[model samples]
Structures are given as C-alpha cells and as structure tokens.
Target: MKEAILAAIKAYDTIILHRHVRPDPDAYGSQMGLATIIQASFPEKQVFSVGNDEASLRFLGKVDEIADELYQDALVIVCDTANTARISDRRYTAGKMLIKIDHHPNDEPYGDLVWVDTSASSCSEMIVSFYETFQEELTLHEEAARLLYAGIVGDTGRFMYPSTTSETFRLTAKLVHFPFDRPALYRHLYEQSLPMTRLAGYILEHFQMEEGGAATVFLPEELLTRFEVDPREASGLVNVIDSAVGLKAWIMFIQEGDVIRARLRSKGPVINELAKEYGGGGHPLASGATIHTLEEMAEMKRKLIAICLETV
Candidate 1:
C-alpha cells in the first residue's frame, strides 16, 4: 500500500492534501507533514494542503489557499479522517485520484486507495512510516518532523494513552532528533487562555461521577457564555477529569450551535460503539458523537453509564 501511495505521489504533478473538519493536531500533522516532505523532495510538483485554518494549531503550519482548478488532474490524499462526511473540503473528490490514510476504524472506507491502520498511534505516525519506507526517495526535514511529532504526541496524550506502542516511542525518538524546538511545540499545543482556564476550573468542580465509574460534564451554551469560552475551545478540556479516581470512562458534552458535541474517553470500555449509535465514530478508547437535543444528551449519558457498568 505504501508503495502504491508512493507511486501515486511520483506520478502526479499536482497533489492536494486534506484532513478532517474541526481540525486537531493530528489532522494538521499528517496532512501537512506529508505535504512538507513531498514539497521538499519534489520541488517541481505543485503541492497544497487545503482546509479551514485551525487557529490553535497554526503554530505547527498554515494551510494553503489554492484555486479549485488545481484539483484538475491532481492527486488528493486525505489524512486522519475516517469517513467522507468528516473530510474538511468538498474538493477532495475533484482530483483525479483519491487516497485515504487514517488511524481510525475503516467502517465507511470511501477512497480509491484506502490505508487505515487502527493500531497506529496517529495518522502522523503512519506518515513517518511512509517516509521511512522510501527514505532514499523522500525528504523529511525539521518542519515535517515537528508536525508529525506533534500529531503523535497529541493523539497519544504525550505518550500517556494506551495507543502509544514500542514503535510509537521508537519513531518519536527519531522525530525528536530534528532541530525543531520541542518545548515550544509543547507550549503551543497545550497552552490555554484565561477564559479556557476558568472553564476548566468549572468543569473540574462541577463534573459528576456516577456509581458505575462514568464521569460526565455538560457545558450548555449558557455556561459557555458565562465562562466566555468558545464551544470549539471547550473541546480541549474533555480530559480534564480523566485522572479522577475510579473513573472508567468520561464524556464531555459541549453545546455547539443547535447541536451538542460529545467527546468520550475511556480507560477500559469500548465507547466507539456508543458513538456510532449517535452518528459518530472513532477509536474505542476515544470517540465523539453529536446530540440534537438535551433529551438525547441525557440518553447518551445513560447509555455511557450502562457501557461502563458492563465493563466493570
């Protein structure tokens, strides 16, 4: 599969990269990391990474603004996004060929060449592996290393999550050898604003822990307004209560416009099934879902509580 992807890259003169919507570190990491590598290695090719700019992740790299006509005869590669609906830009299909590289479950599987490795820590990790496969033909410099490193660290929770394997650490060790500033990258990826800090305090204080080891917090629009934090920013605090004792799993529900977004995390139980029931899916330990109403959110809580109970 890596050989085929490499062949595709070599064959195309114009390549466009994309990732999931409402981007995270991993999304930008894999998409732009691969782009940087290709751009450096093949200076003649027109490479572009397109998506709505994620403000918090701009420290790693900025996205390119390319004309839609560029997709003509272009090779489009999407990273970290599992399903077609979650892809950021609609122009992904406009290219001559479509490739999907992701670390999530391959349920939807909507590309001409699909490579989904759930065991991999993040899509960025897979990108590193791709470069390693063709080291002689590919170029991986400081910027590519920094972006891919950030993705692996973010998805693995700074190597705290269970997804981090021996290979993850080994590849991460290689990434750190680059000249990029690790301390600055860490600061950029994790630093919170004052309002976000206040919101975290509120979540820590008010989050409820159920008897079945299911912890939950509901951040309605009103509460978000009180803290003056954007709903998108509040998603970062989903793991604020992860260290709470006896917590088998946790869910953070943040109101976003007419829909409520649920970020689910687990220590043991598989919660992606629950996420799937609500029209969302991701890793078993970490998944996300959307709720249309407060009643639906309550039902989701009940279902999560039941899942935790079963695991216990």
Candidate 2:
C-alpha cells in the first residue's frame, strides 16, 4: 500500500491534502507534515493542504486557500480522518484520485486507495514511516519533523497512552534528530489560557462518579459562556478527571450548538461500542459520540455505567 501511495504521489503534478473537521494536533500534524515532505522533496509539484484554519494549531502551520480548479486534476490525500462526513473539505472528491491515511477504525472506508492502520499511534507516525520507507526519494525537514512529532505526542498523550508501542518510540527517536524546538512545541501544544484553566478547574470540581466506575461531566453552553471558552477548547479537558480514584471510564459531554458532543475515555472497558451506538466511533480506550438532547446524554451515561460494571 505504501508503494502504491508513493507511485500515486510520483504520478501527480498537483496534490492536495486534507484532515478531519474541527482539527486537532494529530489532524494538522499529519496533513501539513506530509504536505511539507512532498513540497520539500518535489519542489516542482504543486502541493497544498486545505482545511479551515484552527486558531490553536496556527503555531504548527497555516492551511492554504487554493482555487477550486486546483482539484480538477489534483491528487487528494486525506489524513487522520476516518469517515467521509468527518472530512473537513467536501472538495476532496473533486480530484482525480483520493487516498485515505488514518489510524482510526476502518468502519466507513471511502477512498480509491485506503490505508488504515489502527495499530499505528497516530497518522503522523505513519507519515514518518512512509518517509523512512523511501528516504532516498523523500525529503523530510525540520518543519515536517516538528509537525509529525506533535501529532504523535498529542495522540499518545506524551507517550502515556497504551497506543505508544516500541515502533512509536523508535520512529519518534528519528524525528528528534531534526533541529526543532521541542520545548517550544510542548509549550504551544499544552499552554492553556486563563479561561480554559478555569474551565478545567470547573470540570475537576463538578465531574460525578458512578458506583460502577463511570465518571461524567456535562458542560452546557451556558457554563461554557460563563467560562468564555469555545466548545472545541473545552473538549481538551476530557482528561482532567482521568486520574481520579476509582475511575474506570469517563465521559465529557460538551454542548455544541444543538448537538451535545461526548468525549469518552476508558482504562479497561470498551467504550467505542457505546460511541458507535450514538453515531460516533474511535479507539477502544478513547472514542467520541454525539447526543441530541440532555435526555439522550443521560441514557448514554447509563449505558457507559453498565459497560464499566461488566468489565469490572
């Protein structure tokens, strides 16, 4: 599959990259990191990464605003996005060919050339492996290194998650060889604003725990308004209560417009199954779902509690 993707890259003169909507570090890291590599290696080819600009991730790199005609004959490659609905840009299908590179479950595979590696720590790690596989033909610079490293770190929780395998560390070791400011990257990725800090404090103070080891916190839009934080920014605090005693799994429900988004995390129980029941799916230990109403959110909490109890 890597050989096939490489051949596709070599065949195209104009290549466009994409990631998931409401982008995270991994999404930006993989999309732009691969773009940087291709642009550096093939200076003559027209390469662009298209997506909405995420303010928090602006430190990594900015996205491009190319003409729609660019996709007329372009090779579109999406990274870190699992399903079609989650893809940031709808123009991904306007290209001549489409490639999917992701680390999520291949539940809704939608590409001409799909490459899904759930075992890989992040899509950025897979990008590094791709570069390493054909180092002679590919060029990776400091910027690409920084982006890929950030993706791996974000998805792995700074190597704290179980997804961090021996290969993850081995590839990460290679990324550090480039001359990038690792400390600054850490600061940019983790430094929280005062409002976000207060929001985290609020979450830590108010999250509830069930007898079956299911922890949950619901952040209504009004509470977010009180904290002056965006719904996307509040999602970052899902792990604020992860270390709480007797917690087997946790869910952070943040209201975004009309739908309530659920960020689910578990230590042992399989929660992605629950996520799927509610129109979301991700890793077993980490997943997400959507709720339409407060009543639905309560029902999800009951199901998660049952799952945790079964695991125990």
Candidate 3:
C-alpha cells in the first residue's frame, strides 16, 4: 500500500488533500501533516490542503484554496474521512488519480488506491507508519511531526483511549523527538475561552443521566448565539461527561439546522455499531450520527441506553 501510494505521489506533479466536513483536529492534522511531509520529501511536487475554516483552529494551520483547473491532472488523497458524503470538498473526484488513506472501518472503497487500517489509532499514526517504510527517501520535520502528533493525541485522547496501542506510543515517542514545542501544542489544543468553559458547565447541568449508566445531552441551535460560539465547537461539550464516576456511555445531540448531530462516547461498550443504526459510524468507543428531529434523538438515546444497560 505504501509503495502504491508513493508511486501515485511520484506519478502526479500536483496533489490535493481533503478530509471530512466541520473539521476536527485529527482531520486537519492528518490532511496538513501528509501535505507537509509530501511537499518536504518531494520538493518538486505541488501539494495543497483544502477545507473550510474553523476560526478557533486556524492557529494550527491555514486552509488552502486552489483553482479547479489544478485538479485536472492532480492526485487527490482523502484522509481521516470514511465516505464521500462527509468529504468537505466534493471536487476531489476531479483529480486525475485518487487514493484513500484512512483509519476508519472500510465500508466503501472510493479510491483508485485504497488503504484503510482499522487497527491504527488515527490516520496520522497511519501516515507515520507509511513514511517509516521509506524513511531514507522521506524527511520528517518539526512542522509535520507537530501536526501528526496533534492528530494522534486528539484521536487517542492523550494516550488514554483503548485504541492507543503500543505502536501508537512508539511512533509518538519518536514524534516528540522533533524540535516543536509539545507544551505549546497542548495549550493550543486544550485551552478554551471563558464562554466555552461556562457552556461546558451548562452541558453538565442539563445532562440526562439514566440509572442504566447512560447519559444524554441536548443543546439547541439557539444556544450557539447565546454562548457566542461556532456550532463546530459544541462537539467539545461532550467531554464534560467523560469523567463521571459511574457513567458508562454518553451522547451529545446538538440541533444543527434540520438535523440533530450526535457525538457518542462509551467507557466499555461498543457504541459505533449503534451509531451505524443511524446514518453515521466511527470508532467503537467514539462515534457520531445524525437524525431529523429532537424526538428522533430521544428515541436513539433510549435505544442507546438499553444497549449500555446490557453492557453493564
């Protein structure tokens, strides 16, 4: 797979990178990290990262905008994304050749060269493993290392998640050897504004914790303006319920336009399979889905609670 991906990289002079919509740190990190490493390793290649901006995350890396004509002969690499519906820029199909490098379960194969590693902790981890195969040809620098490390940390929950394998630690050990400031990277990743802190308090106060060890959170669209935050930031609100002593599973449902987007997390149970019941799926411990109404979110919550109870 590495040979095939590297061959595609060498075959095409222009390359465009993309990830899922409403970008998370892992998405941005994997997309930007790959582009950075590729550009540095193959200096002659034109590599670009494309997506919309989350103002709160621009401190990490700037989003790139390119002309549509460039895709005519370009190689597109979609990272950290599961399916086409979730891709930020639909124009990826315009590329001359396509590759899918993802850590998500292989539900659909959309690329000419597809490499999906479900065992990897994150897509960034997979990229590190990819470059390690041809270490002599590729150069790993501080900028790329910092971005990749951030992605691994974000997706692994700072080495606490079950997916954080020994290989994850080994790759991360070498990643931190680079010149970037690890402390500064962490500050940027975890620090929140005062309003965001207060909103987290609100989320905890309104949580619907069931005796069955499941918890549910509901935040209406109107709360976004009240909190003066981008709707994208609401996903972090789910973290408030993560550390509760007896909580086995939790879900955050934020009303976004016509759909209620759910962010689900579990301490022991396999919840991604439940996420699959709706139109979404992800890692076993962390997942997401979307439903049409708050009532549907309630129904999903009840079903999820039942599943959590069984796990207990």
Candidate 2's residue-wise lDDT over 1-312, tens digit each?
A: 999999999999999999999899999999999999999999999999999989889999999999999999999999999899999989999999999999999988888999999999999999999999999999999999999999999999999999999999999999999989999999999999999999999999999999699999999999999999999889999998988889999999999999999999999999999999998988999999888998999999999999988996
> All predictions: root-mean-square deviation over Cα?
0.9, 0.8, 1.2
Where does the lowest 10-residue lDDT sum fall in candidate 1?
303-312
Cα lDDT over the full model 2: 0.95
Indicate the residue-level lDDT of 43 in model 2: 98
Tens digits of per-residue lDDT for model 1 on 189-248? 989999999999999999999969998999999999989998988999998888889999
Q: Alpha carbon lDDT of residue 47, candidate 3? A: 91
lDDT, residue 146, candidate 2: 97
TM-score of each: 0.98, 0.99, 0.97
Let me know the TM-score candidate 1 reaches against the reference structure.
0.98
- Considering summed lDDT, which 10 consecutive residues are worst modelled in model 2? 303-312
Ranking of predictions according to lDDT? 2, 1, 3
Q: Candidate 2 has what TM-score?
A: 0.99
| Cα distance off (Å), candidate 3, residue 306 | 0.8
Candidate 3 — which pairs collide? none
lDDT of 2 at 76: 98
- Flag the better candidate by lDDT, 1 or 3: 1
